[model samples]
Target: MFDRLRLMSDYEAPTPVWAPASVGAFVLSPTHLDHLGLDETLRTRLLRWQQYFDDHHPADLCGWDSPGSSQRYASEGEQLREELERALPGLRVELDLWPVPADD
Candidate 1:
């Protein structure tokens, strides 16, 4: 089993990306779901989370402009973290919040 799994949203895109806690450079997107060592049930959950994130957040940076955007993002991240923990007990799950946008 992987030591750690991190869930994060990047500026390049709002989609959630999962990576090892020790390594941020190597990430697994939702599409790369082939022999990932994760069982089909977990893989399906991860993909569902990705799709949910993509659907709720804007694909570009403009998403930050909307009111309560930060809170919304954090809420989703928290939910994902909870899901990860429930699905993989004892696994370290980190939710890396993106930089907060400046108030206009």
Candidate 2:
């Protein structure tokens, strides 16, 4: 996704993860990506995942934190995460509340 950007081996992608949605999880990476190219690169990856998530799942499946929402395609989400891990190892799926970019 970020093929144009100058990627680095040390660059850690900011994965979105759930955290009760009330207290919230550290959706974005805590580490500062000082490199402009790297930040954009990470965002590109995130946005791609966001699009995939939106397209595959229903809008109301906010997270496990939602009321009576635990059973809404629960395994599907996990499958997505697993697929992501297998596809992009080392970068755990942490994306939860991070908003995906609009198709511009």
Candidate 3:
């Protein structure tokens, strides 16, 4: 799912947005379905995550035009952290950015 999001970010050509039809499809298989029941809480969290990706991230990424982009990223990162805490308890999400040397 993260890879798909990155690919969408890298894409230059205009294209239709893609979102997963079902979180279950991305996070579980038929064999695992029994173990992980489809519940309201999980559904709500997945919908929120999907909506954030579809709306918030794209708007920020497209409108980014300043030195404070990192701040915006950090803000979004914090939101994701909070959401993950409530949704997946004990799960950790980290964001890392590496600067390329000026010589590059």
Candidate of highest TM-score: 1
Candidate 2: regions farther than 4 A off? 1-26, 29-37, 60-104
> What lDDT does each candidate get?
0.60, 0.36, 0.35
Q: Which candidate is the best by lDDT?
A: 1
For candidate 2, lDDT tens digit of each residue in 46-79?
Answer: 4444444444433565423332333332333455
Evaluated at residue 55, the lDDT of candidate 2 is 43
Clashing pairs in 1: none
TM-scores vs. true structure, each candidate: 0.60, 0.27, 0.31
lDDT of 1 at 85: 76
* Candidate 3 ranges with C-alpha deviation above 4 Å: 1-64, 97-104
For model 3, the local distance difference test gives 0.35
Candidate 2: which pairs clash? 15-94, 16-94, 16-95, 17-94, 17-95
Model 3 per-residue lDDT at 88: 40
Query: lDDT tens string, model 1, 1-104?
Result: 36677777553342355667466545665554353445676666556555544555556644555556566666756876786677666778887765444452
Of 1 and 3, the candidate ahead on TM-score is 1
Q: Give the alpha carbon lDDT tens digit for every residue of 10-71 in model 3.
A: 11212112223433213333233223342455434434434444443355465434435434
Judged by whole-model lDDT over C-alpha atoms, candidate 2 comes out at 0.36
Which model, 2 or 3, shows the larger TM-score? 3
